[model samples]
Target chain A: MLKELDPLLHSQLRLGVMSILMSVESAEFTFLKEKTNSTAGNLSVQLDKLSEAGYITIEKSFNGKKPLTTCRINRKGMKAFEDYVNALKDYIKK
Target chain B: MESENKNLSPEQSLDLIASMIRQTQGNVSSGSFYFLLWGWVITLCNFGMYILAKFYSPSNAAFIWTLTIPAWIITMIYASRQDKTRSITTHLDKISMWLWIALGITILPSWIFGSVIDWRVNALVLMPVGMATFVSGIIIRFKPLLFGGITFWIAGTLCFIVSPLDQYLIGGVAMIFGYLLPGYMLRSKK
Candidate 1:
């Protein structure tokens, strides 16, 4: 009776983003891009997927003249992340 | 990293989480700047007041504290700039910011009602500062800051027994230990 790993969180980039979001209150798009070492386009796509799943919230605003995007994990995302980790633990234990 | 959709095994997933967390936690420079800035400002002001009170005029010595007004303005401007430039805000960062703000809120009232409160303002100020520093040390996991916080508390407690003039000198020394030393250590760590 082991828990199943979360499909949404099983991917590399999304998991990386979620992991970063778990430790921080919020992070800019550039920060996620840099930390994940992914292209802006790939990071943007993964971020949108996370947002669509309601795992995280993305806010688009202007920092001076430039467009600024910030991402934060919500309660659902936190629960999902915790569950994913527990599931990983279960798999490893077996 | 470019393989955005690459599926991870359980072990890889766990490793990724741990690594990302380490990366996120690695950026912790925001607190050091403020610690250094306040350390210098408060230490100088304390020593300035001691010098003035000891030699020039006890009556006008309190005027030197007004330097903090300019320091406060600079802090505000610097915070705004930092907010604009910083890409990430960690929970530890927010917690430390609010902790200091809560302590700061208490300080203004203590000064305004100094005559009525009748406690040595040094102790009143240092107690909260010590608490903030201690908690900040725990949050950042920095040993020097923990020692700094202890020094502040000890100096604050001594203020209860010492003369008004000597309190200034003790407080100045405490600032050197509590803020400046740890601040420099934290800066160097970065």
Candidate 2:
């Protein structure tokens, strides 16, 4: 059974972003930027795409005058991850 | 079954994920709280060693007794098996769990080699260990693990600074700060 996923999360960068977010309570923008090895512009674009898909929630705050962005994956995101993994496994199984 | 799947709002999604993580992680290390409760016993013994060493030749018996890497490893294994189901939440739990593991690994070698190697080198052990934990935290974006790793690195810093002239103090500090506090947090998360 295939679980339909938001198109936004399907791309490799977005997928990596979601995977990283799924593994933590929350993460800062700087941290995520470094982890995914994506430039700020690209990561910010992917994150906005994820947020738009309702797969994640983003909070913008300032840490000592510097902008701080933190993100957490939502329930839909979690299920999507499971469903996505399952779908991937299905392909492997075939 | 198809109807069971529905689009969730971000808040709802996060709630579901959080619950899944908790359900799967389901009390890592059954006796962790109890062991942590008794962690003070180790602290007390470490203190007793410090006191005794001040008055006598460096204490070996108590120093040897405080080696905890094996116990830490056993505890880690026990904790990891607590969750079998793989989910996004469970995956994150695995990340934090590995934080504790890397912390253990950081100090383990120091304890094993402290006697044979220069005590000065024992202090250096924290750099790689701390860096590993810190980088993992950054990569995974796990703040709690980051906090734990910071604590380990700070404790490691202390050990590195003082191990040359003082070993038991470092042990005592590591017992209280490194092991006891993080263990409490890991168990207390409900």
Candidate 3:
């Protein structure tokens, strides 16, 4: 029996974001965009979906005059990511 | 990356996870500046004091180590600048920073109190330094730093039987193994 893949994390961009966030304590919006190689508008949308699903938290503040956005994976997100990886492993074994 | 509708196979998902984790791990490049800076500073101070002790009065020789105060101030400035530019903060980074900060706090008091009590404290100071480095290595899973930490502990133990001046020499050699060598290796790895 194979575990079901996480709907929230099955897409390319969303999974990429989760993967990056899972490894670090926190990352800036720009950092995520760069790592994912996604446009700002596209990355922002994916981040919003992840944030809405409670898989991550987005903090918006100011660094001097410019707005700073940082994202961190929450407990739910970590568990979901771990489960997703385990599920992927089960699929790969078959 | 803009194709949001594409579904990945399990193999692709695993590959993505591995790649992202590698990318995040690669961001740990800023540590070399600190290691190199402090390594050179302390190494120079130790050797400088050793050389000065031969020709200068003891009081003058003691003043050489005070260079660390300015070096520390500069480190603070450099660290803040680096921090401002960093886009990611990992758990390991925070733990490593706090461990070194803890070392600084303990070392300062030990140095001052040792001087006041007329006891050589290089050996005493190295013990905590070893602990900090060892634990940091464990956090980062870096073997060189783990070995470097052990080297400091060994040097500190050997210091107990040596003269105060020789302790400076030992400390310098220890820093070479513990900080400079590992520091350079980390830089190259980056």
Candidate 4:
């Protein structure tokens, strides 16, 4: 039986963001922006979507005078990512 | 890499994940400070003690070790500051941190019981130091540190064959190769 890929994770930017978050404890908004090579507006929108889905958490604070945003993948996110990869493998095996 | 927001095929998705993970691995190389600091301190102290013992006075040789107190303080301060400021922390970084902390604890008994162990303390310290270095190298995926760790173990073994005074010389040289050399290389990589 073929498994369905999570629609939320199928897009390029969100997948890239999630991939980077998976590798680290948490990442700054700038770090994600640089790694994904995404514009601020686009990255912010995708991050909000992930946050709304409860796959990840976003922390907004200040690093001195500048606004700092950090993102972390939660347990749900981890499970989802793992499931996504498994589904990916299933597709590849075909 | 712009946010095209386009959906990817399974193959493209897999490729993206692999490349992103590879990019994060480079962050592990930022640990050069501790290695370089300890390398210079230990090496200089070893050489200083050797010179003092051989030339001026064996009694004065032990005084050189006091420098480690300041080294300990600086390491603590640096680690605290780094923790507050670092934007990212990988599992590898956490594992490497705990490994060194455990190794440091293992080495403490040797220092406290230096009189009981005598000058063999150098060899004892080297073993755990080697373990930490070797493991750290593997965690960071750096080859020089892996070799450096082996160098420490070899130096430690050689210390047993030499006179107490000569052990200092070996320890000093070992730090140069095991710690300083790889440390500089890591810094350059960063």
Per-residue lDDT of candidate 3, residues B99-178 (tens digit): 88988998888867776756488888888988987886787678998998999999999989999888889989999999
Which stretches in model 2 have alpha-carbon errors above 4 Å? A1-94, B2-48, B57-59, B66-70, B73-77, B84-89, B102-107, B119-122, B125-151, B163-167, B185-189
Q: How would you encode candidate 1's per-residue C-alpha lDDT over B61-156 as one tens digit per residue?
A: 888888888889988998987876789998878888899899899788877887675435999999889999999999888999999999989999
Ordered list by lDDT, greatest first = 1, 4, 3, 2
Please, what are the lDDT tens digits per residue for candidate 2 over residues A1-94? Answer: 6555455644656766676776666667776666556688877877887888789999876644666677888998888787866655554455
lDDT for each of the candidates?
A: 0.89, 0.58, 0.86, 0.88
By lDDT, the best candidate is 1
Sort every candidate by TM-score, greatest first: 1, 4, 3, 2
Q: Rank the candidates by DockQ, best first.
A: 1, 3, 4, 2
lDDT score of residue B143 within candidate 2: 58
Model 2 residue B59 lDDT? 46
Tens digits of lDDT, candidate 4, B1-190 = 6645566889999999998887777676358999999999999999999999999999767889889899999999999777657777787778888998898899888877876866468899897899899988888889999999999999999988999999999999999999999999999987
Q: What DockQ class does candidate 2 belong to?
A: incorrect
Candidate 1 vs candidate 2, TM-score winner: 1
- Cα lDDT of model 2 by residue, B1-190, tens digit: 0112244444444444454333323322223352364356556656676676577666454453454445556555655543322122334445556665666677676667766764444345545555654555464454554664576577667775564436556645655654467557656764
TM-score of each: 0.87, 0.43, 0.78, 0.81
What is the number of backbone collisions in each predicted candidate, taken in the order shown? 0, 6, 0, 0
